[model samples]
Target: MLLEGKIVLVTGVLTPSSIAFTCARLAQEQGATVVLTSFGRALSVTQRAARRLPTPPEVLELDVTDPEHLAALPEHLAERYGRVDGVVHAVGFAPAVCLGQEDGLFAAEWADVATAIQVSAFSLPALAKALKPLMRPRSAIVGLDFDASVAWPAYDWMGVAKAALESAARYLARDLGASDIRVNLVAAGPLKTVAARSIPGFSQIQEVWAERAPLGWDVEDPEPAARAVVALLSDWFPATTGEIVHVDGGVHAIGAAIRPPAPEPEPEPEPA
Candidate 1:
């Protein structure tokens, strides 16, 4: 039980297939008491997923963009656990306009981009700050991430937001280090989560990963990524923080595996 007796908060679980849901389930199997967060219409979806876990988890309402929800998290956790040992910030969203096919980068208005950044990136520090009072030394905070170091066809502003998330994780590591709280990101490869389906041509990225990830990749299975999140949440990564661990089948390390077209058979040679 890597997470034995730990109290963990997981966000963004909309379905059993969600990475967060898998994390919650694995966390419980590892002896942690898991709590999930959802808001409005998606709350029911998360609730259904929670029931499917080996041990059903409690669900809390938390719209990360809502200041009130942010302010109330500490109190919410205080009532049940008193202190939080780990938190998985598995939340992210961007408006349609911010995605490339709908509007592309230039056509997306600042407001839409701002929404993406605030929810996906800014919320990392916001969640950390909100939960600080309830966090203990050695507590871990993990966030879900997509590789933002390079651009993809349709990721657009969401990619930008993820880049910001990468930076925020580093800053969080620096600031929260004194508190002995760890902050890190798990940059997972594309998977068939509800969120990924919303991105236009996401399959393109999936195809790229299949060719590039040296260990190969699975767009359907999120368990590998979930396992990474659980590891970061456990005591194993005590000395590791402000890091982005790519669970993308090693795709992040090398250039595309797509071979150049056989040089056109050297143009039949200059035999004349």
Candidate 2:
């Protein structure tokens, strides 16, 4: 019950397996009342997923790219919950072609890449700004992230977007800290969620993580990441902000382990 009585807004839940869905479930289990957001056709999907949570929450319309929707969030959230305690930004998307290939950065249209940056990166601050009024002092803002320290094989524009997200969180922490608001990102290992499955060659990243992480990993289990998110949402992280907490089973901290060399060949009888 660490989050008892908190009101949190969770976005980007497309299905039951979604990381956002797991967070919503955990939040509710800890006594927090959760609200969800989705847009367009995905709204229905999110709505369905909401019912599967421990306590079903109201699903609100939120098209992050739409100015009108962003403007309406505060009032909408106000009507749903008197005030918001935390916000979980799980939204991200990128066109297929934007993922650079071995040849080079893909020839995908720049417009698509720009869209990815805006939604995945720039949207974090925008969300904080929009929800500033609703958030209480000490309110927490958490966003989903992927480690962007190096170029991902096929992550393409989305990689750029995540880097921006990391930077954006730092700036938000600086500006919002004075307001007693906290901003942070959880850099999770890849899960087979709808969003991740959309990325090409995502399995390659998964395989590498499995081999590299000492604790081992389950690409199908998003609960570990969800729990980390809930901890940040709770009062436990009151003093922590502008940080990226890696929940990737420590994969981000080390390089792949070298394979053991084949057993030395038996010495020749002549040598004996």
Clash number for each model:
0, 0
Clashing pairs in 2: none
Taken over the whole model, the C-alpha lDDT of each candidate is: 0.92, 0.89
lDDT of 1 by residue, 140-187 (tens): 999999999999989999999999999999999999999999999999
User: lDDT of candidate 2 vs native?
Assistant: 0.89
Give the TM-score of each candidate.
0.94, 0.94
* Candidate 1 local distance difference test against the native: 0.92
Reference-based lDDT, residue 206, model 1 = 82
Error of 2 at 111 (Å): 0.8
Off by over 4 Å in 2: 100-103, 258-272
